[model samples]
Target: MNAENEDFVRRRQLQVQRELEDATRDEVVVEPETGRLPVCIESALPSKCIVSFDAHESEVNALCWSPSGRLLASGGGDRKVKLWTVLRGQHQCMGQYLGSNRAINSVTFDDEENLVLAADNDMASRVWGVSDFRLKRS
Candidate 1:
């Protein structure tokens, strides 16, 4: 690649690394009574929206919270699965998992949290590596 192109890619990589670092540094503060999440008095559960973000281009169809609740996986009508890092009620888009040809209908994280699996409108299911966002199976 040309020097300028390489420089641009390098800068982008650094930016992503910094974002990841910031997300990881922030801790999720859980209330003792609510277990691992905060509670809403009106609902008597953790149903409150502490924060929100533009998660997808189209309507979100499915959402799955990681075992630790630190990460969230969302599949949308836009044919994409996006990962989010949630810390202390704040959220940031971490990465996107691509490969679905149709809108995703459901999503879940593997028990080990190593893979993200989604079912799409195409009548197909796909699995992607959590860390690398590589398609593992379809």
Candidate 2:
């Protein structure tokens, strides 16, 4: 590769590394009270969280199931948002978003489920493209 091309590649790599580092700088938290997730929740005991639920290690503040019910999104006190997809036999975590610098309080999917939106304690809101898990706007 030419020197100009190499320099461009190095700058791109550094940009990606910086973004990743920024994403990882979120606060850690411990579990809090249990509540019903805003989806097709099963009946629960007074004090139990569903075992297979995509629970955060800390408090979960918001949840939204896709329009087709094939995907689920959640945001929480852990400063992260996660996406779960339901297959024939199980729910799998397909992606985890750690770009929120503060606790997330609301999460929702667009009508077509092609995008996800979240609101954070920092008084900021963000939009992400579901297909590539990239930030579309903030």
Candidate 3:
């Protein structure tokens, strides 16, 4: 064989040998700490449930906490967006915003917290006034 051909064969053989070694090597398994998350975010998250309540008639699809942390908005498969007031680890249903004919998929509050918006499977977006729970736009 030519010198170039011989050199190529030698390099190919070395590559195959390295591949075989890597394929047969034992992999080390690292165990994660039980009931713990990464340090960077663990402190920001609540460690346990504070309270629970029936937020919707059907499965809840979306949830958003108001900027003040006092109110929570939830969208559900029942085609409703409901708001809750949180105080002393207890929650009360403030009211519900209705309009969408299909299941709601997302809910959020505007930056000013004056309006709550929801997107639904009906291919529409709706906004409601936080003060009145009346539909503002859709």
Candidate 4:
């Protein structure tokens, strides 16, 4: 490789190394009174019950915990939305919605925990009933 190519490769390697080190470091310093809260690391394992759903063939793009913290909603690049229940360090897929023709990007639950909103690359936003998993139109 040329000098410029070697330099570029070295810089890229350094960046990758830094990212990997950061990913493995657990540098949580919680000082509640200081108002400086620590951010949760995505790769860190869940404390109690953890559930992973495989309904999506593509990457999971968004995830949200339910109001009661018992359920989790996951949207992905597979154009599907899935609901999971956490129990004893495992996640159980409770339901799925294949409403969008494109990848689902985001998901959120209403404060009452009765409704869920999902946004997708198809330029569509949908609301669904949590209890019956029925689509709600506005």
Highest lDDT, which number?
Answer: 1
Task: Give per-residue lDDT, candidate 4, residue 113.
Answer: 92
Model 2: per-residue Cα lDDT over 14-89, one tens digit each: 9987776665564444334654343322332235533356468798899898999989898999998999886765
lDDT: the better of candidates 3 and 4: 3
| lDDT for each residue of candidate 3 in 1-138, tens digit (9 for 90 to 100) | 699998998999999877767655645444475655443331222359988888888989999999988899999999999999989988889899998999999999988999999999989999999999899998
Candidate 1's C-alpha runs over 4 A off are 1-47
lDDT, each prediction:
0.89, 0.83, 0.87, 0.82
Q: How close is candidate 4 to the true structure, as a TM-score?
A: 0.63
**What tens-digit string does per-residue lDDT give for candidate 1 at 8-30?**
98999999877867765665576
**Overall local distance difference test of candidate 1:** 0.89
Worst 10 residues of 4 by lDDT: 44-53
TM-score of each: 0.66, 0.60, 0.67, 0.63
Candidate 4: tens digits of C-alpha lDDT, residues 1-138: 699998998999999877877776756678879987666634542356344446578889999999999888999998888898877777688898767778888999999998989998878899988888888952
- In model 4, which residue pairs have backbone atoms overlapping below 3 Å? 51-91
